[model samples]
Target chain A: MTRTSTLSPVPPADAAAEPTRVAVSTVIFTLRRLPGSETASVALPLVRRTRDPHEGLWALPGGWLDATEGLDAAASRTLAETTGLAPSYLEQLYAFGAVDRSPSRVVSIVYWALIRPDEIADASDENVQWFDAASLPGLAFDHNQIVDYALWRLRNKVGYSRIAHGLLADEFTLAELREVYEAILGRRLDPANFRRQVENSGTLIPTDRFRTGSHRPARLYRYNQDVELADRGPLDRRQ
Target chain B: MTRTSTLSPVPPADAAAEPTRVAVSTVIFTLRRLPGSETASVALPLVRRTRDPHEGLWALPGGWLDATEGLDAAASRTLAETTGLAPSYLEQLYAFGAVDRSPSRVVSIVYWALIRPDEIADASDENVQWFDAASLPGLAFDHNQIVDYALWRLRNKVGYSRIAHGLLADEFTLAELREVYEAILGRRLDPANFRRQVENSGTLIPTDRFRTGSHRPARLYRYNQDVELADRGPLDRRQ
Candidate 1:
């Protein structure tokens, strides 16, 4: 995409002095098996700030928006650059622009993304570390609130969208699928109900393959790619 | 509400030359009776741009984001300043920051709002006029695409939220409530099913008042104040 440089033929004299910097941030959630817990819990990666303002504090992985890239592209670039992680399911969360949110006027176009557990290997950055989304420390700026909102969106979208598929493998047992939901929702769901509900939704394709577990072999199912992970509606275009 | 001057302690010398100006805009929806239609249709106020970069074209009511106000406050201020309407239901829509969206880079923190028909009397601005949202002409910037996204959000949220209540007065009949949905969804709905659904949802309360229409006296129902108009979840606080 080509970038537009200036607003007017004769630019405002004070534009440079009061430029509103645009930043792109992401809340990347993945399920990590808790230390001694039987089930996994939702976790996200945060990067420690290196500069002043909130230096040494943890914040969402992000960077300044490049002039030539679209918002989605900018988000993907930032996510990849900071944590070396790519998201499976990415959606714009919110535009946080409180006057006092930053030391300078900064508008963050926050995107929430879902990363599969297997893709978490790239989080080898020294400044990057995974933390339980539920028990996060005091983060830089309004990041704590931003994560809370992203978590809310994740839980809310999981109910109606096939977003849980983003956190799972290509094929998984019903038990595995339920585990993802349980981890994010922090609740135990009835297996029978979940199975019936997913089956009735027609978004899952039951496969002949089975996962051999300690107790029994369970049927594996793959998500129907025809169904979108999230309903973006009219704004589904890549732009 | 104090504004931060700049982001860095030592301001970038070329900040104005490569500035990311922030703009605030709103898509305020209200029900308007069509010329001959029996039911009201979804309508929104549009402003005629008098400046370059799509001059003389109709656009969403908006203004440059002030450095001193919160996003929600900026949206409310712009909505009132340009269109002279205050939204009963106001929610962040999306941030549109495509590189080539304008002659200059503008990150618009767009908001979609709902105003009751009774509140539209404040819309006396000559440059601001109401238009059928379903058949809007070409708009300024990427506003056409922005409106499409907002319309989608409106239709999608109408299914799960009490946003329709924003288009109605405190006391309204079941038929009145159903009309708002039908207008927004652009389809007919079974009155019986809608009544049962809204009744079971427990978002409305039956009042002793009744609207004595030409046919029959339909009982007037008032929206349950205890229930929120929309489920913002964890971000319900007015940031």
Candidate 2:
């Protein structure tokens, strides 16, 4: 995605003595069924820091920004390196740049992503471990706060966007879809109200297929690709 | 805001030869009524580039990230330096870090701000000038695209948040508030619908004060400070 460089040239002497460094990080979320329970919970992968500043502590999977790629590219590369899985949905979360965030002056451009449950099987890394989003340990740096913000955004976005599709298979039962929202929001939604709201949203298309093995066969539905995953307003993938 | 650096100490030898530099930029939007015009339009201040790349081209008000300051502080400082005015509302917009977007590997944490009409009086800088957002000249770097994103966010946020209060005076009639939305959205919103929507939002506090004019006296209102400027969702000003 390299194009002609457009910024004005700066003299080496004019540049500051210590340039602030940029890093890329991601909070990848998926759902995990609790052991011995039918309910699923929101879960995310955290990498144990191998070196200093909070060494031995869990942190979001990330790395320093590469000089040759865009921010999004860097995020994808770091995510793959750490977790070995491509995200079904990825978006820029926020840029954290408090002076005390790191030893050296480092600004982290954090991204939040969602991976389908089936796709999580592809992620196999030694240092990476999954933890329930609701019960995370003290993490490295300000990652605890970062994760909190990401979770808030995920829950808020689910209310309006079709991003729940990112965590589901190509087709799913209405109950399955409601479970995804329930896991993120941590609330028991009235099943009938949930069904009515989702059906009216127009982003779901009922399929002819139905899932068996349940007391009553529930109809399967697919997302309308025509409608966007979410309303990004006028934004595209350009940046 | 600086504290003792906590990250594992990096050997100077391990540092990258060229670290990615972080820059802070802001898009300050306000409403301006042109001479003899009845309706207002969205306008923003821009700084002219004085250095080599895209020199003499207009760009958003901004500067480099100071190593000692937090991201928000950097944004506030740079914005004041560029435009000589403090914003009534400022929020992180987006981070642009395309390696080829600049001559150097620069990552910009961009913010969008809103200034009330009274505050615009303080913004009289030499290189700073206001331009109609709808029709801007080719800007420096990827700023043309950045401005487009900020405008999109501004229009989108106005629909949901009390950020419109940032563009209004302390006390105003319902008609005045609607004008801010109309100017930003570039359309005439139905007065009745707009009134009901805003009143139902519970973010406005009706006052006994009224403005008597050529027609009927309209009651004035103030924003409820208890309600947040916007729903940032579990995030605070810590950044």
Candidate 3:
């Protein structure tokens, strides 16, 4: 390998003045199953930055990572700071560092989180709102790239894992769960096949509680307490 | 949320004199099948850092990102600088920012790349050597975390995609391919079922050439040039 002086010397004085800093940001998503729509749509929470750098522009809710905090703690903290909502589950998504990504020397470790839409009845702050994946405003920095990658992972992993359930309450009806999948997938699925697949996966357990509404009573189900799918295997390919 | 200023800002005069700055490093990996191994083991090319902080430590070949370089570019540049390797497929893995991770403020954005091992070998430099995943040394920083995630992803993703082929020669035998899978999965698979699954997935195309060995001529197989599996769905199921 050719050794360059560039790699040998310590970083310059200006570099030291603004030493590279660590931050944690997140793309929190929930599937909104819109009735009468062709398919459910994916929505992500965004906060308009109240400070500079990309002040006034929309971006994922995140901020500086605390030195004593772990990655997961930082993510939850940032989310709560901007959205006033606590995500139940979070996973490391990707890290964003392009030299000029920020005017300041900042590199952010991005995480993806899933939340149920009903849990967020309304925007707690004016700066925060859910934007449909298809119609998003200009995002600050390389956040657009982070959102794209998170969407790609979600779409690709849903087949093997029952990720759709995360976008819903602990107990939900079959139709409600199906709608969550359809929203993220952006296509209508055969109701029968979708139910069969979920059932076969053995990740969901039926409950006696039923959803009572306009037409008829629908059976309710909750995630299987005994089986923790994330710890099981690579893709959770049970069904 | 309550805001607190925990750390005092660095004095401007002292900041100018500090030569070294903190930055993150990355060690992207992909599976590579070698001639000697019983099966294809996870192989990553490592380069010895010649500078302080980790002067002689054998580390994943990476370095400081320019203030203008994105995290992705820094990773790509590190791979090119140390190993003369460029991967067509690369994705951000994770960030390691434990305060003690680096003597300097370097918090690395590790990436994972999937490519045919042949490509890496052909691009090999004097400083680079491929090490089996199961048998690796104590790496420079939190690289062990990055490697662990990559291995976990390989073990998880190979079931759905033709990821093993990314580690093999363009033309390979079924036995060679199976070894790659077994090495990553860490288990013995029924060869008959494995073959059946690969064929049924429709990701492999049979080539006209055959490899003549001690027993018989093994038919050569190549990755299907066309079928790209669409992203599966959301990743937030159990959460």
Q: Model 2: per-residue lDDT, tens digit, A39-72?
A: 8999999887778877788889888777788888
Worst 10 residues of 1 chain A by lDDT: A1-10
Model 2's CAPRI class is acceptable
**Measured by TM-score, how close is model 2 to the native structure?**
0.91
- For each candidate, C-alpha RMSD in Å? 5.1, 5.2, 5.9
Per-residue lDDT tens digits for candidate 1, residues B77-133, read: 777777667765578989988888888777888998788878877544567888999
Tens-place lDDT digits, model 1, residues A176-210: 88988898888999999988998898888998999
**lDDT for model 3:** 0.67
Span of ten consecutive residues with least summed lDDT in model 2 chain B: B1-10
Q: Which residue segments of model 1 deviate by more than 4 Å?
A: A1-16, B1-16, B159-161
What's candidate 2's DockQ score?
Answer: 0.34
Leading candidate by DockQ: 2
lDDT of 2 by residue, B13-114 (tens): 334566677788889888889999999999998888877677788888777777788888988887877667687557899999877777777788999878
User: Model 2 chain A: which ten-residue window has the lowest total lDDT?
Assistant: A1-10
Please give the distance, in angstroms, between residue B175's alpha carbon in candidate 1 and its true position after superposition. Answer: 1.4
Pick by TM-score: 1 or 3, better one: 1
Q: Provide chain B TM-scores across all predictions.
A: 0.89, 0.89, 0.74
The candidates' interface RMSDs, in order, read 9.1, 8.9, 7.0
